[model samples]
Target: MKSRYILAALLATATVMPVASFAQQSAPAPAAANPASQIPAADKQAIQNFNLTDDVFNRIVKVSQEAKAQGIKPKDAKTDFSKIHSLDDLAKQVTDSDPRIAPLIKKYGFTPREFLLANLAVTNAAIASEAKGNPRMAAYVDQSKVNQKNVAFYEAHKGQINALMNEEPDPAAK
Candidate 1:
């Protein structure tokens, strides 16, 4: 069986994990189930390339809330998606602990340490911005932006990062 299929089966058996954004969040496998009894080819590639699971998406949703609390106006973020790295990292920043995130550590094959560093770097940018008027805050802000940018660089290449997840390298890449 393919890795994607294998991951889907395990998630379907687990039940709590649902593919929320891709399909209506109801139950497991509904996302994969027949809207047409066949998935469109573009969507198939998109789902695989998206490199994120529904559970992860749900967790990432919290980042918007976090952004609000940090005083980053929607316009501020929208004009510069660079502020959040990419759509995926934008979602990843505010994630709290979810039980489903555990099995996904293996299945998704994410580099947790790297991801956490990236997540925190972005969060700290907001934190640093608050300090800009204060000299102490300025120092921290400079440091935070540096951290955020460093992590963002990695995040900026999410397509490449995603290429590594829940998938095997194509023979041609070799």
Candidate 2:
């Protein structure tokens, strides 16, 4: 009984003193030579497969929203968002005639819409930097069919793919 009491006291003291958490600091890291800043191979490919019609942009936006709801930590979601300037930029990019991305997507069997949704999840993290009236955000004129496709992709892949970039297990807790 005496040992139990001492153990409890020690545990209480440790809890009260606190310990450093592994959580990353809220501040953005300093700009430096880092690969995370560069768009990954997948992102670049999705850009070439993109068809920048309004429909596609709308779809990508919906995918981004769905990604957020699915516990996707934007900062860590897939590739970094800083690589994209705006929805238009992204749509145009995915639709670009990049020789690299188009062939890769063909090999992977990813539909253009699927590629676009993935692009949104990856890039939405960059919004913090672009939201300050970045001309890249663009004005919303209307929604389109591709928008619906994006939302659907988000619904289907939100857990599987969108979750990839955001999930970080609590190893210490284990």
lDDT top scorer: 2
Backbone clash total for model 2 is: 7
Model 2 C-alpha lDDT per residue in residues 76-139, reported as the tens digit of each score: 1222234543333333344352333434444444454455434443233222222324544322
In model 2, the worst 10-residue window by lDDT is: 14-23
Candidate 1 backbone overlaps, count: 1
lDDT for predicted candidate 2 compared with the true structure: 0.33
**Tens-place lDDT digits, model 1, residues 25-106:** 2344443343212334443233223333334433433332232233222121122223332233433432222333434443
Q: What overall lDDT goes with each candidate model?
A: 0.32, 0.33
Among these predictions, the greatest TM-score belongs to: 1
On a 0 to 100 scale, what is the lDDT of residue 23 in model 2?
A: 12
Residue 102 displacement (Å), model 2: 12
lDDT of candidate 2 at residue 112, scale 0 to 100: 43
